[model samples]
Target: MTDAVSYPEPLAHPEKRGIELIESSERHGRARDLFPVWAAPNVSVLNFTVGATLILLGMELWQAFLVIIAGSLPWILTGIVATSGPAAGTSGSVITRAIYGIRGNRVVVAFFGWFISAVFLALNWLASSFMGAELLAQIGFTDPVLVPVLVTIIVAAITVLVAVFGHSLILRSYPVVASVLLAIFLLVTAFVLPHVQWGYTAPAPLEGLPLWSAMTIGFAILASSPLSYSNSPDLARYLPTSTKPSHIIAATALGGALPAIFFTSVGALLATGIDSAAMDLGIESALLALLPAWLGPIFVVGVIINTIALNGMTTYTASMAFQSIGVPIRRIPSAVVVGAIGTALTIYLVMSTSLLDAVNLMLQLLVLISGPTMTVFATDVILRRNRYSGDDLFDEQPGSRFWYSGGWHVPGLLAIGLGAAVASLFLTSSVWTGPIAAAMGFLDLSVPVSMVVTAGVYIALTRLAAKRRPTAIPSIEGAPA
Candidate 1:
């Protein structure tokens, strides 16, 4: 047998590979190493914002906790999907060729994957810019217009710098980042917890359909956080094939879910101490008001760092998605492009919209697409038993195994279409409420509806297709179970 390709190790260098298969020789790392990789990004002020938003939605403290746990469970699906990384030896964007066909996969990657990543990149930059601008104002650099503009540029530059350095640098840096963010957040928790009203509830608690609607909305908002990580395999693809699927699942799931749950719960607690009027000012301002003045700068710094950690991971996967979509660009340039576009979006949103309102609407709408897409991906992984041929997956010729039905896997496309269509009818948001949701007292069933329909339809269609054409389903023998 010929020797496997050698690649550079973790160092201060830009990652050279994009959607290309990682050679076995180049795959090195314990599956557990993924914990920090997933965790650090999620140790975010956004989670805190989410928690506060849940309280604002009229959920009692206990109800919010239930929503947080239930909503975050989707990370388990994300973890299951991560196992495909070691099995396929390629990023998630590339692996979808087996499910959607080479040509069809491009459309999904370009729109569903890359577009969502870019939106998230912009959101993270915007959040961090606000915090960075606050830090400047505290230090007497308080020109409202110029401060935000300058801060956004600085935040974008820092985030792009980390992403441009690529995979090895990200893996090496995230553990330290996770450690620092966790420590600082814990300190914030200590300061905020003493003031929490343990038995707090809305003075006029929601009843019946209103309560259910509130719960469903909260669930959709929280679940959207994990569902958006459908591209998680981009980070896990470099692990050795011998790595246990269980370990990868455990590490990735817990790494993300733990910090998310904790920080969100903290937000819930912090919200209990603030009046609705203070909360209307924004979660960041309310949170800072609760902390000692000395900790303000430190808290702002933590928020900026958290944003960098999250956006760095986002931009990395987005660059891979860019290359996967047949973009004739290298990884480094793709990073720059994604960064530039994200920066532009951030600037526009800052100037025109209420950041919190934009965030809420985006999260609600995001679940309509992200839920079905992730469900389809996770379902495909299970059907194949996590077995894929990295070399065969890259074949894009007309008669190649992945080129089913003239470069489209009809079942996958049809499933996603039917799923998203049905889900949209159940969507509930300030911007638009679907017909079904309106009739049902505005209950948001979009998240669960999309996932169930996508999985069920994809499975049924894939089986029927297999009966007609045996080669329609590619099989690889001796793959690790």
Candidate 2:
């Protein structure tokens, strides 16, 4: 019946097909506004919640005002401010296009993004759920465990809804929420100021524990530095490239820093009044106590709002990772699925493990994955000897750096995995064999060490891999636009 069997040109190369679809994704909401995407700030509440662990850290290791100020301040400022979300709407692909080559190797970017996201989804769910539920109990909510689950469900729903509407809404909405958060932080810190024991703990121990032990207990738990992490760039993709990147960075930094300062004050205040603050009063309850009776509902609303703000990011990033992986699920569908997955896992965490461990693990991985992903982009765009700039947005040549070896990059993959693995063994292995000694200690190096390893390995591997393989593939039309 067929005069001659022949397949369409695009059908011959599935990689090329993959490229075309992803390129179309770059074009969503072309007519939408850019300000919303670039300006919508992420306000992380971990500044306060993280105090639960840091309170414990202060008691166990060192609570040096200087060190806490140093470690926590920049993280608070840079994390929230330096970070922005990915693109959405008309200009969404524009930022990504700028980061990757114009030849459109987003697939390569997506691969790494997926790995990073899978881990982050697990962290966000567990951290927010445990923190939310515990906070409810602090306010005397009945059956604290059950209360966290319900709150988690509500939170996941709100984030999914916001994300479904798109980043424009997220951007416009965040500023309002952030304003309220600021007032709350300021008021609470002022209330607690009278209690700071400058006379008693004035020169808080700059060196309390052994170096290794301090690293194990202190930095491991302290890594959630909400200032640096909360306002990730997943939503910022909507800003017009014409919008200066530096401006976006500065705004987020300022927004995120405020929370860090407030949270650190709360932690130090809690420590200062150690004689008075009950074990149960720990962190969340302490803040609740600082508020007037009239403000209880407002405080609860604050917790709920913060949960929504960050979890929205979790769901959004999780969906992008899934979409990039070519899941049959659409963005909305993927958001719901990932949200449920995070919530369910969090429920398991609340029931079984120490919530603090879960918090540490998540923060560690966040630092680890983020470093490599950021480095790859900066290197690919800024450092590559061969440039692929411009509206080369639709270009998706096969065997390109992104499409090489069937779209699996062993170099980046190996670097990331190795970094995570090595950090786990050296930094956290409970059975300490020897110390080379006391380098990182028997603690988690998810952030500091991972950054070191990721940067070192990615560059080294890329250089080695580049020598044998040609930098660019043949500029053929058979695959990708």
**Candidate 1, overall lDDT?**
0.85
Q: Give lDDT tens digits, candidate 2, residues 1-481.
A: 1122111213222111111222222332221332222222233345444544554444422453443454444333332222222222212222244333333325534554544444545455554565566556656886857876776677767767765554445555666766776676556567666765655433334243343354444454454343224224454444443444455555554454445555654665555654543534434555556567667556656656666666665556556544443456556676677677766766776676544455555554455445444444433333342133223333345544455455455665666577656555544422331242245434444455655676577667666655555343211111111
Compared with the true structure, the alpha-carbon lDDT of candidate 2 equals 0.47
Candidate 1 Cα outliers beyond 4 Å, as residue runs: 1-5, 8-10, 474-481
lDDT for every model? Answer: 0.85, 0.47
Please state the error at residue 387 of candidate 1 in Å: 0.6
lDDT of 1 by residue, 451-474 (tens): 999998998888777765556563
Indicate the residue-level lDDT of 413 in model 2: 60
The true-versus-predicted C-alpha distance at residue 83 of model 2, in Å, is 9.6
Largest lDDT belongs to which candidate? 1
Query: How far out, in Å, is residue 276 in model 1?
Result: 2.0
